[model samples]
Target: MNDAAMPKGPATALEHFDVLIVGAGISGIGGAYHLKQQCPGKSFVVLETLESFGGTWLTHTYPGIRSDSDLYTFGYRFKPWVGPPIATADEILKYMGEVIEENDLSPHIRYRHRITNATWSSRDNLWTVEAERLDTGQAVAFTCNFLWMCQGYYRHSEGYTPEWPGMADFKGRIVHPQTWPDDLDLKDKKVVVIGSGATAATLVPAIADDCGHVTLLQRSPTYFIPGRNANELADILRELKIDEAWIHEIVRRKILHDQDLFTRRSFEEPEAVKQELLAGVSAFVGPEITEKHFTPSYRPWRQRIAFVPDGDIFQCVNRGKASVVTDEIERFTEQGILLKSGQELEADIVITATGFNLNVLGDISFAVDGKPLNFADTVTYRGMMFTGVPNLVWVFGYFRASWTLRADLVADFVCRLLTHMDEKGARKVTVELRPEDKDMPLSAWIDPENFNPGYLMRGMHLLPKRGDKPEWQHSQDYWREKEELPLIDLDDSAFVYAGTKARTPEPVG
Candidate 1:
């Protein structure tokens, strides 16, 4: 048992930590906070692939880029978002930097460190991870007892850009919002935004006045709900001189309650809610235009419903600054795009505001005991951890509510689990499906057929499966999970707690 007798291998040559978080975004930053507050003894590092800390906020710089969800719940549970309910990307990035500086997380972040592979060892109870510096292509390695994934469920390298017929023939400047250029000029140009998603909605109103003409070209309609841009309650409360902490708590709770009610109505009584939403749109731009462009084919909550602050998109359309075209692209001509209906759209700049591709764990390869880890073969546990995956947590946020709500809860659960392991002196903790539940009906995560969103549909086969069993289920309902996860009994036999490692750690080439 001499300290010098241990084998010197790839793991031995690499840096080690108690916990290795794979992102430095909203979820990852919150994870760091929980780790510090609950388990102060654990040493951790946040490895970010980008040059900056904010993941989405820093990566996306399109004009009018702002939060889809209100900042009250989108913000960290420990901190208060005192600014506008909907914050701009710049403000959000600044907030993230403040959190890093105030909490002293700057030194722990290794920017441009893209984790490419992760291998787990049963004997050593550690993960030997390999990453590469994006700028220099230099290899880097790190070892950690637990690995946390908070990189969001999308590809950072590129957005999903579907190839259209004759796209190469387009003479105009084509731009994808994900990889927007910095110096590109678009002053007083006839710009066409192709898509009906949130990104397209955001861009149209933003560039309406600046550009000579802007058009939102969509193959199909998307649900649009008009929301208030500013928080009136916070303004009124400040007049009465209420403290910010109280204002934040009261506003957060009120927003959560409203979100829960809206989600429930979408499921329980969709028709009524659908009419209410469409009526709001009709009030802005008559029923004729609403029928042509605003009404969606599918029901609400089946797909993402984009929130347009103060009917900005509708206002732009009514003023003749922007217009909506519900049609499909026939082909890209030299001057512009040709529609299937024989309509031609002359554009100086064509911006593809299409969404991203859902990339689980940032497309990082995983292995255990030298065997490749296939996510399709594994099942999810409590929407965060995967079956047979030891000491790894995947941070996926909520669909109906603010992303940070689920993130905060997941972080808390992880902290609690780590504290328990430390208290029990357990060397390895693994989640595996019990034999009694082998016959349980396992299905695709959210059933690709049922999942209507294009981003998730494109990468459905790559995601982990979920079963009907309670332990194997991944609930999207925030209110239900809020009540279940924190108080869930951890004494289940499915999760194995062991004090001995099966083998020593080694790295793969």
Candidate 2:
């Protein structure tokens, strides 16, 4: 916590700032950097619920918790990532810490400040944010001219784990990776991990040697890209004695360009892309094993493709340290899990690597002018701002590209919007549907046909709607957004700016 920026008023009094940023994670830190660099005059403070920074990386303590996406693109654009493409949780934390230290961001960040409610006052052109100190249990109030939400999309307190029948009867311990116990003893323990997502893949290889035997159980197979973690482009650039910053930018752009092509190929040539992905895994596990436990029914990119460095999971399987099982769970038995195929897998411990529960707006209660706000009732403006919401922007990143890509883009947009507001002397800015877009078809936040993750699907009803117009929807296209976002016209009809003209005071006499 930065004592200098700490609220010094009474508990009931409001500590004010020009902008209030939520969360101190990657997006929040990036937002802070952009704000300080671009809008140096604006006063701001960051409120984070966690004890420290590194949101997901700090929260997840499961064995082998690492990035599924390469760090070259995952890392911030302003910062240089010199490590391997695939980095562990500790490495990511170190990288994020460096960003904070290098940029002198610690002074503006207030950790353990959990925002509970936010209310917008249209008349006053401000937002009243209510939070409580996790350490002191004291309520705090804050007023900000604008709100920037970068709290991330999922609940970090607990992971999503489906209840199994007879789970209570099971004698072994059951744990969810999101809340992995620090004292968890896996030595010589026969462990069965549920779900075959990135978490399971990462965990199996990390603990395979310690466990007597580890099994990855999945209801259905999922796609993975298994390859060397090193980035050839970055290695070559380094060998050429290139500056680290230049190497970072060069490698990042190259990876993104290739990613764009791969994304296009996935949609255009689905089967070819699918075969290419499976072939990568087949190199280590053989075609038979790949077909049995690695082949997904859906086409490539239906869900996220976890990247496995050096095919570690398959290597563990070859060494007889780990095994993969593809079957639906019947129920939990006294010994372990009973499969629908009438197979009983005995295990001393069960780890659920299941996904997460989506969190909308940090699950913070929001109100506008004393009226409760239901996010689902509003429409999204490029998936950042809401139709009726004023002076607030949320950072919702891409599903395909690195999340930081969109975060950086949104930071740029917010800073630009803030600067525009200052120039126009406007205090409130809200996005509204234009007359031409009044009859545009409204749909789910995202098109399920395009991308549908389980967490998003479960929480779709709670999210805002999307309109047919590109401005009224989040395209989730980094390639297009990188160009279109900065070019967005703030003076367009979709934007409603107010509080510019000062009201004349009635007779003083």
Best by TM-score: 2
TM-score of each: 0.94, 0.96
Clashes per candidate (backbone, < 3 Å) = 1, 0
lDDT of 2 by residue, 178-215 (tens): 99999999999999999988999999999999999999
Clashing pairs in 2: none
| List of clashing residue pairs for candidate 1 | 123-503
Q: Can you write out model 1's per-residue Cα lDDT over 300-374, one digit (the tens) per residue?
A: 888877678898999999999998999999988988999999999999899998889888888899999899999
Model 1 — which ten-residue stretch has the worst lDDT?
3-12
At residue 234, candidate 1 shows an lDDT of 79
The whole-model C-alpha lDDT of candidate 2 against the native structure comes to 0.92
Identify the runs in model 1 with alpha carbons over 4 angstroms from their true place: 1-12, 448-451, 501-509
